[model samples]
Target: MVRMAVHQSRGRTQIKDSRRGCPRYQPHKGKSLTFGIRPEHVTEKRVHTASSQVDFSADVQVVEPMGMDTMVFFSVKGTDICARSAPQAVVGAGHRMEFTVDLHHMHLIDPEKNRVIGHRSDDKAKTSD
Candidate 1:
């Protein structure tokens, strides 16, 4: 669970999320910050085109370090989503914060899957046919 503070005009509000861990949001008069609980996300789909067909995957993750005091931005680059933060802090100590986003939307690829795809090397040798 993450605990954070939402800075208000008068003071700040402490917030908490079980899924994302401790996060604090500090708001300014004319600006605000957002943070993503998950560090990475991957979307897999089949891309169809008149010329050819190919597998397309959109991998996204919070570029900045994931911590209690960080802000997240929602923007896509060539269909890829990238989580970014403003100059201000998003997660902090005890401050009340709230969210209306579904944590499930932030999906990351399983590490085990990388091994099966030959991205990781194994010491064992293959058998002859």
Candidate 2:
């Protein structure tokens, strides 16, 4: 897990989705939270159950081609996130690219304890009644 912090409202992002539909990042109230995202989990624009996704448009900061996929880098909430993209991703620097995060695969940690305390789950997105 990586240690990170954001403003009260920074955890959420909004995408003026070209597809008209967009994903949402459910807020975390944990005073301290750390999380890790894998490149493969970062994919081309996609939509899952509304509560299970986080979609955003990011600047294509860097693209490095690997044997089968390209390593993409961009910043979100001031943290650089890396992604494994198709080798054919011709996205170059300065262009905006949309990315999707599948909540089922994400891990969250309690920073002080340095152990994973939760996984980003769609089930948690339900507004408490």
TM per candidate = 0.19, 0.64
- The sequence of per-residue lDDT tens digits that candidate 2 reaches over residues 1-129 is 355432233445222222212123234342556767678988767656666677777998988888888888888768888887776654887888887776556655666666554333434654442
Give the per-residue lDDT of model 1 (tens digit) for 36-117.
Answer: 3342222122233322222222222333454533443333333324333332433332332222333433222223242221
Poorest stretch of ten by lDDT in candidate 1: 21-30
TM-score of candidate 2 to 2 decimals: 0.64
Which residue ranges in model 1 land beyond 4 Å of their true spot? Answer: 1-92, 115-129
Candidate 2: segments with Cα more than 4 A from true spot: 1-29, 47-51, 118-129
